[model samples]
Target: MNIFAAIADPVRRSLLEQLAREGPTRVVDLTRGRGISRPAVSRHLRVLGDAGLVRAIDHGRERHFELVTDALAEVSNWTATLTAKSASAPQPPVAGHHLDALGLEVRRTVRERGTQPGTRHTAASSTATGEIA
Candidate 1:
């Protein structure tokens, strides 16, 4: 299961939060007071385990599962990368009255010159109220 997809389920996310807050715990400890069934909790844990979101340790007859934060860190790192890239990206020219006026001038120039068919460039003319032709 995808890590993000696994975390999408509230129960699985709650399990992760519980593991984070309470530290490593056994299956019984995880499900003892919860309304969810033991088998359901086990299934959730399996999905988390597949996603590397949790790690399990077997001690005697009990299986203890703990949050493996490294997987979450990977997600964090991916978001950070996207954030950094966006921050460094160039901003587009802001559209305002100035741009609207410039667009009018361009349209008028195109109307005066007219457009040539089969040319690489084609221009559309619009009125001040923005009716297009």
Candidate 2:
């Protein structure tokens, strides 16, 4: 099972959280007060074990399960790379910002050329005035 798929279930995630919080724990302790049967929790734990997200150790007659955080490095790296790319990505222009910038540029160009509103230098006027150059 894929690590992501193993942790996708709410029950499995809860079990991992419990293991991480309480360190190594027994199956009976894990099922206590959770309203889930020991067999069901064991099945979930088996999935987690297959995904390398958790490990089980036997001490005498009891089995202890503990979280294996190293298994999540792939997920962590993937998310971190996505976050970095998004942080460096160019943001989309805000509404009306492009128009506002265009308006300012037009105003600046008109001011520089000393052109008046509703008046423009046409090809005919430039040719007649010999100002084509």
Q: In candidate 2, what are the lDDT values of residues 1-133, reduced to their tens digit?
A: 9988998999999999999999999999999988999999999999999999999999999999999999989889989999999999987767688889988998888898666755786888767777773
TM-score of each: 0.61, 0.69
For candidate 1, the 10 contiguous residues with the lowest summed lDDT are 117-126
Tens-digit lDDT string for candidate 1 (46-74)? 99999999999988988899999989987
Highest TM-score against the true fold, candidate:
2
Give the 10-residue window scoring lowest on summed lDDT in candidate 2: 112-121
User: Which portions of model 2 show Cα errors greater than 4 Å?
Assistant: 93-133
Q: In candidate 1, which residue ranges exceed 4 Å CA deviation?
A: 85-133
What are the RMSD figures for all models against the true structure?
8.9, 6.3
